[model samples]
Target: MKRLVLVALVALALGGCATTAPYGNFVQPPVTVDQQQLAGDAAKQLAALWPPAKTRFELQQPTPDEFGAALVGNLRSSGYAVLEYAPQKASGAGNATPEQKDADPVVVVTPTTVALPLRYVLDHDAGTGLYRLTLLVGSQSITRPYLEQNRVLIPAGYWVRKE
Candidate 1:
């Protein structure tokens, strides 16, 4: 009986871990198949405007976050190497000269949200007393980001994709 109970406990523990989503920063950005596919197209379009070199990008966060990741992933999937650029911090070596590392130019990718309606449904099985998520759609636009003049406008879905 003791051994059987231990085995059941171990199984339960493992199952709990298995249910967790995989994401390091913030919640897994709520992204759909269509969202990724459309974002991929946007990345390709942006790539064409720049010279044929590895394009580094400064993603406007929550531009939305998931959409940004999708954009970067799609850009990579499209055979282009991408890097995130952060402005170099001032080296406080007071007279210590730092090596000048040449870097490829980076473009700031910003997202602009549009209005759209997303309905969410929640269902509770009375017998189980557990609430289940039936829908994740958000009230925001599903339009992909676009470049106007010089700015890259991301869609509202990225913003409202979560909350």
Candidate 2:
């Protein structure tokens, strides 16, 4: 009887050792938003005729510094006022040159990604995931036909300010 009880205790100990903390507790490393979306013809058409607007801007990305350069380039080409936060000493030059000129609104873009649970395991643990993010400023002001068509539209409430 005592031997049987000892064996049972050993089994319990082994089972306890086999248990592990869930994977959800780990912090996910930040990811970049590589996909680019344009406001399309309406914006391009408007920008072409109208002079670029003067404004202050800042772009924040959860990814690396190079992501900022890409965003700046895209925004400039689309005709938005893009500056490095100082409106007074703004450089009218973008990745493009003077003859072609770029777009306006002095846009600041911040791109980031957040992990979303795919499904809960046993109704309490996240098994897989996805990322959803959006532009906090001027997102509503402009229409993104490509984003809508692709179904990558960031919902209204998911806006997170880029730091």
Candidate 3:
């Protein structure tokens, strides 16, 4: 009985080390308004935190949805060299750019390039009729709330940054 109990405890301890994916499915509901404005707002806030010309990002989520595409465009327009690829596949691939369909093949790392991993989450609160956008970069994050009225989304509050 003592040996059996010890074995069970060891198995449970090993199981505790397992981890799931860090990211969840991006929630983008259909809206009548263009998402570029919202995405541009987010990009502007991000650029304020980390200068786009000095920073490079590897986007962890590669969803081809409207918000994702718009965010990428906004980031690029802000002068950020964003990398869109699967994190798992990029492992052990060195600095070589991975081949992706319909994506620009250019992910070069330089000495001055501040490469940081980035992810975003957009969620809508049905009860309050507000949308929240969260952008995570490395160990830092910024969140902003937006309200949709007259078929347009506008910032509802000041952006909050967390380190």
**Candidate 1 C-alpha lDDT tens digits along 13-127:** 9999689332222213242223454456555554554332444443322233544566667666666545443446796546544542333435677544321212222222346
Worst 10 residues of 2 by lDDT: 116-125
Q: What TM-score fits each model?
A: 0.31, 0.27, 0.70
lDDT to native, each model: 0.40, 0.36, 0.79
* Model 1 lDDT, full chain set: 0.40
Best by TM-score: 3
Cα miss at 91, model 3 (Å)?
Answer: 9.6
**Model 2 per-residue lDDT at 152:** 43
As for candidate 1, its clashing pairs are 62-65, 111-154, 112-154, 118-138
RMSD of each: 16.8, 18.4, 8.7
Rank order by TM-score, top first?
A: 3, 1, 2
| Candidate 2 per-residue lDDT over residues 61-94, each given as its tens digit | 2222332345556556765655443325566466
Count backbone clashes in candidate 1: 4
Q: Of the pair 2 and 3, which is ahead by TM-score?
A: 3
Q: Candidate 3 lDDT, tens digit per residue, 1-163? A: 9999999999998887574334522445556666778888988888888887888988887757788888888999899998885756445436445554445756886656657988888877779988888888897888898898998898899999888
Among all candidates shown, the one with the greatest lDDT: 3
